[model samples]
Target: MATVAGVAVEGGHWIGGERVSSPTTFDDVSPIDEKVIAEISRGGEREARAAVEAAGKAFPSWSRTSREERARLLHAIADGVEKRLDQLAIVETTDNGALLRSHLRGVMPRVAHNFRFFADWLLTLGHEDFETRGHRNHVSWDPAGVCALITPWNAPLMLATWKIAPALAAGNTVVLKPAEWTPLTASLLADITAQAGLPDGVFNVVQGYGAEAGAALVADPGVRRVSFTGSVPTARHISTAAAANLTPLSLELGGKSPLLVFADSDLDLAVDLAVEQYDNAGQVCLSAVRLLVEESVAEEFTARFVAKASALNQGDPRDLATDIGPQIHRRQFERIDGFVQRARAEGATALIGGGPNTDLGGLYYRPTLFTGVAAGSEIVNEEVFGPVLTLQTFRTEEQAVEMANSTRFGLAATLATGSEERAARVSERLVAGTVWVNCFFVRDLKAPFGGSRQSGVGREGGDWSFDFYCDLKNTVTAPWEK
Candidate 1:
């Protein structure tokens, strides 16, 4: 274990309810100041295999547990998470460089909610049963056994629990391989779950890079199902590895989502949503980074949007006043800088924040807004995963929809319009899986949440989550009055 800035890091894998260490370790660097925060256990194929085997051994007993028992345990887990809310929030902010205010207010709460929601949802879950021609048919959802969950760095606990809660509630053992950059919180979560009285091997965490532990976890034949939230290219690699065993996968990949602002929209509200692209420094997959405004109000919207974005405070995430924080690491910082530089070279005009916030130093990037962006250009179509926004104009509703659906990615979209009819009509046509009308990033745990097209493969929320974590079976009976 190592300590930095009063935060202690447990640099080991949590396997079968115990801490397992590796001979080799890797430095866990904080993007806040580019300092080595901890040295984490460097898990490889062997560790991944051990974790999976532990989960496999626990599956039969866990899968056989009553739904009531599972629900009770999940509630306990949620309670445990709530108890450590402040500590978890601060640790996550330190690890990932996301604003502590945001984590404390929303992200940490949502994490606990993920467990509670799934726990209660599991209790109320009802399967389909029908009778036709005096014959009975029943549909049952059974735990699928060992589940492999690979989560990303951004919003680590929230996103990881989005998959873990449902997987556990559905009575499947989970082997989680959190992103190496932000592995601390996941390690902490393992301890929390254990304290919550979860059975050994029911939930496990392996800390390492994606290619090593992540690849091994996905490629393991013992893994009955896989849920991954990350980039599209990595999804493809996981797809290839899982294809070998014909294992089912639920992928929540990258997005170049669009936000369409109509002329009738409230100018102030529209600006607020547009500026939200910089939330968590724009690492959000569901963020509408591509701003498509009606030509009638393009000038007004762009002016207000740029103003709000430019005013965003980029500083230490622990500060309550900060709106934006550093990129996860130097590599991500360089990646964002590259995108801005290329956009500049390609003739796009930056209305605000063209480069790094050198005043703040470290990995902090300015909230950037680019106009005069060419259609189908690299900046317009690619997922920058940074605090960068690109603006474009559309002449009519048709053009707006066309521009919104133009990209290969379609994870989510935001539409702002005063007309209720137009909101309904436009939302129906958006290619993304989830469309927010007159709002941004407002989510309901019961709603089906995932992506479409290149953005992702399947949905997960409410019963949709169980569909991935469990195997469905149909039981039919012949007429009793034959």
Candidate 2:
């Protein structure tokens, strides 16, 4: 075990309300300084099977528990998360290399909010009943046994809870297999839920590689539902494994989302939003890394964007003044650099940063912007998932929409314009799950949040979450008089 930011890291898996170790372990490295923070258990099929069994065993009693009781337990989980907010934030920042301020102010708080919101929403959830052909039909939502939640390392804890809270609220037991790169916070969350008076075996975690443990979890017949957030290739693999049992899946995969800036839009506001692409070091799936500006204002927008990006302080994530931190791992760092190199080789011009930030060292890539990017080029159409933005100019609203929808991904898009008509019309035509008018990353927990096309398979938020976590049952009754 190793200590991160004074918090003693638990290196074993949390299974059946107890800590479980494996015969082998792997190093958990921090991207910030390239340090080995902990030795995590290397679980394979054995641990995955045990976790699924535990969840399956608990499903009977847990699913039968009253909704009010489930709601109370969910609130208690939120209380536990809030109590350990500072500790969790520090550990997460140390593990993932995200700015400490972001975890403190936004990410960690949202983790607690996820539980609280789902808990309250569960109490008010309802189904419809109607009469037709002199008969009554009743619709009910029932928990769908064990849920396999495979979350990414980008925003580990927050994203895990986004799936966990709703699954539990819907009375389904969960087995969360967090990304191998950032596994600390998920272990802590398991502890938090256990402390919150959740029943034994209701929630379990198995720490290991995706190929072994993750594959085993998804392939198990007991796992009735699977929710994954990561690369498209990984989602395809998980989908294949889950297809064995015809288990339903909710996949929130990669994105090359676009930010469309109109000439009439406020230059400063548009610039600010464009700079946000570097947030979380541009690891955010919903980040509009592709900037499609109207040709009339393309030059001005590029100048302002380049200036803002240049001024961003890339340094130690622990420092409050640091605007961005390191990529999540060395491999990710290389991947980003490769994208930049290929883009340059493909004739795109680097307006500002084009490579690693050597001054600060250690996995830090400078905030980069590329102009003259061809419409169908790999750099323009593919997801870099880094602190890199590609600029393209469009002459008309139709062209902007075409450029935005050109990518195979349709996760999210941002439209910046002054005219209300343009906002409505452009947003409607843009092929994405979420379209923000003159804004970016503003999320409402109750709203439908998931991608479209290759971006994702299903939606999950509010009732949409319940729709996936629970099985819908429709019962019809004949009229008594008949």
Give RMSD (Å) of candidate 1 vs. truth: 1.2
- Tens digit of lDDT per residue, candidate 1, span 1-482? 86645666588999999999999999888999999889999999999999999999999999999999999999898899899888889999999999999999999999999999999999888776899787799988899999999999999999999999999999999999999899989988998999989999999999999999999999999999999999999999999999999999999999999999999999899999889889999889999999999998998888787777767788999999999999998999999999999999999998999899989888999988999999999999999999999999999999999999999998999999999999998999999999998888889999999999999999999999998898998888997763
lDDT string, candidate 2, 315-359, tens digits: 999998999899999999999999999999999999988999888
Report lDDT per candidate.
0.92, 0.93
RMSD of each: 1.2, 1.0
**lDDT at 51, model 1:** 98
All candidates' TM-scores? Answer: 0.98, 0.99
In model 2, how large is the Cα lDDT of residue 61?
Answer: 99
Error of 1 at 273 (Å): 0.6
- Which stretches in model 2 have alpha-carbon errors above 4 Å? none
